[model samples]
Target: MTNFEEDISVYNFVSILGECFQNKASVNLVKHYPTGRMLAVKRFHLDKIWDNISIVQQEITLTKQLQHPNIITYYTSFVHGPEVFAVSPLQAFGSCKSLLDSHFNEGLPELAIILIFKDIIEAVNYLHKSGFIHRAIRASHILISASGKASLSGLHYACPLVINGRWQRAVHSFPLSTQPNLNWLSPELLEQNLKGYNEKSDIYSLGILCCELANGREPFADVDSTLMLVEKVRGCIPGLLDCTTLPSKCDDRECQGDCDIEISLSRRGFSQYLHEFCYMCLEREAKDRPSAAELLTHPVFTLVNKGISLPELLKPVLPLSDKVSPNKEMCHLDHVLHMSEMDMPSCDWDFPIS
Candidate 1:
């Protein structure tokens, strides 16, 4: 067996839940003592703890503040000497990566692809509405739960907003690392020309994640980080090798102008609506990209067949007694303003209700 499997055995783990990309952490499915309930333990080594403390803190803070079914639920956190750990519900199917790897050969059915993308977009829209930007969005960071639901994980790089009048900038202390995964970074981030990454960066990463989901491969799997950086600077978008066959003259060229032809051809599996969403997300100019709220209202998510507005589809039908209290509404608005300021947006929304 491999060293990883040996390590898993040593940990007395029931199963290896998932492997992280940077080797910074690992998630294991283990039986909790006494209760014997299954749980996911995210273990980060002591050596990387100092560098990752902010990340752990961010995860804790963000999870506590944002409550959504599609977002990964944080059960608890603990510290054992230099090592820090966070426990969440175990996902039986592992990550989106595992699913793609196992099913790629057979190809993903259209219904399955639609379901996955819908889940991911919902999670992302929730984060955006809550005033958080998930800087690291990739296939590995998305978990497929036992109930066949997709949940987003990893918020170490998430930026909280701090609103100052009509302007926003990311919280000052949570510094951007010199080395970030360039493969999934947007063009503005690669050039370091962008002052702050707002919701749009998350959108760009989502586009890459969509590419991975449809093709069963990482968007730029073969390219090294440096080359990926170079390619991104030259406006070279990544393409997919595997795609579902479509009828002739499908006109999948909806997202054509954003990148080189190679990238466009690879995205044939995506519908025109999905293509447009990805294109808006991958826009080189941040201002050109759609907001999370806007994305939630897109035709891909709208209940067009039923003639229902996007908001109507997302509206909760709870009884009046369970409606949001005035105090809670104020708190949520305050949080949104704070987030908008940190994002450094030109204007902030002043809700009429407030």
Candidate 2:
């Protein structure tokens, strides 16, 4: 039998109610025969033994460290033979990817898109505050819960903060044969210099996700992979193509240079606030890009809030019962908060690596 068939057989007696979603990394669904209530099962393929060890270890470690409602809860992890399995709260509505696919032919509701973005940003901020960086932040990683709440999943790419006071770069390099989602990569990552990627890269990816939401289609859908990479490296900006009620310019530029204002004016339009948020995220300069925490306070995000502070906005709606022990949470939170508050007493926000 195939790996999937073998894995399904083990959980087969549990009776899968339905297939909720499937992605490059996981298949999510609710099961019934094992119990009367709903449950989320994430089945990981162990046949590809190349990176399974590290991915599995990171998933368990990251899940244990994170505690937020916007993050999908990790109930338990089990090793059944060669396959690794994890159980969490199942979201009946599936993922943002599924929703976007269904509505691509038409269009997603602006409010729904805003709400989803808010949840994603809040989740990322929480992760950053907790001293973890989710290297992979995409539509498929977001789960729309049964109650319509968006939660982030897929911690396999997450990495803990290196305590050596060095800014470690991402080690997960994409192969040349596999075309990367250039629309989601920051210019720094796409550049030939091979400059290391950091949290700012995640922000760039988030900007692409926003574009997808606004246009109701994948960013650079028609562009071939090679041309997409070239444009990305050359700083080709993407604009909304679906809605005509917004503005033409993607964002305000202090200097228009030689570019024709008329051409800029003819581009697709989007909500001014949303466009600004996307532009800030897509900024070529990493330092200019807002941190996830700062983005939570931006006008685009704050405009949708009733009266929530950044910390409050970072809090998840779900209870922390599914999280690791309170003591562990406190330790992790304390360390992260302390690190965040640390200011270089001598170097003006710069730390010397030695």
Candidate 3:
């Protein structure tokens, strides 16, 4: 607080480079005029801040307590007038959702997903050990650091299970504005029943995250919310799409395509281990899902190429340092890179991949 150089405020940082999707519209990208350093400053709306002040304070307190390499920590936060500014480092690649929008529309490579998920699961494991549940764990909440580290953020919805110094069975409260995360939420959380839900709910969301990363689209994209909810409760599970799961192109109605089911490992798209992992994650009963720590031991993670770095797997996608400027125009021009558009099955979540 003594030196102005260490301080970040509206006066020192100038202009909004881009809007941050982490907390919807509350965070903005600001650049320091002299050093040309960019950072995100989170500012809640004055009118809405009063209504959600408890949640805001809870997020700040939780961030200070939850320290992990994979979790996002703030540089400093101070109140200026009616707004509170929480400044943090600018992730070079932005949120994974941005990546899906600019590049990698057909999902990221398997190695890249492994690298990112490993970091995210580590964070989730830490939170679970600390008796907290990160209600939001979707791709949109994940950011790729300049050094290829994945950071789990958007902690406003995170809540603690330890109340009155006692570990509770489950939490009955629902997350605010649940619509955006409806597709990824566990059935119990959506059901809001007296039985309640526990940290296992987050594991279910994590499973949906895998499917999202692998398939390059939401698990229940464009489906009716009411119908999706009903199906999810009735044991409808989404999966990582690949040749192993999808029916053969040559569909003989009479034969029912059952005879050609046995395919070589080389011809199959994703490995059997991945399918099994997803199956465990998407188990209809919350108790059936594996814990974050348990999931880390799965063989699918063994496929991670330890030899190659995450940045290498993300070829042709330049980090901010590689770019000339933060200008949206310069960053979005897709002239040099060529991406393969995945011809994913256009059916709904009910698509019979068998």
TM-score per model over all chains: 0.66, 0.67, 0.81
Q: Note the residue pairs that clash in candidate 3.
A: none
| Residues 32-59 of candidate 2: C-alpha lDDT, one tens digit per residue | 3334334556555466443445656666
Error of 3 at 320 (Å): 2.2
Kindly report which residue stretches of model 2 are placed more than 4 angstroms away from their true locations once superposed.
1-28, 32-35, 48-51, 104-106, 160-182, 192-194, 242-269, 302-354
Ranking by TM-score: 3, 2, 1
Model 1 lDDT at residue 200: 77
lDDT for position 95 in model 3: 72
- Winner on lDDT between 2 and 3 is 3
Q: Please write out the lDDT profile of model 3 over residues 1-354, one tens digit for every residue.
A: 322133433323333334332232244445645556666556554454676677677777887788898888776677756556676666777677767666876677777887888899999999999999888778878888778999888687787899999998899988875766889899889889999999999999988998888767778887899999998989899888666666545446576443343222113476677778778988999999999999889888888867878888887788764563445322221221111122222111000000
How does model 1 score by TM-score? 0.66
Could you tally the backbone clashes for each prediction? 11, 0, 0
The TM-score of predicted model 3 comes to: 0.81
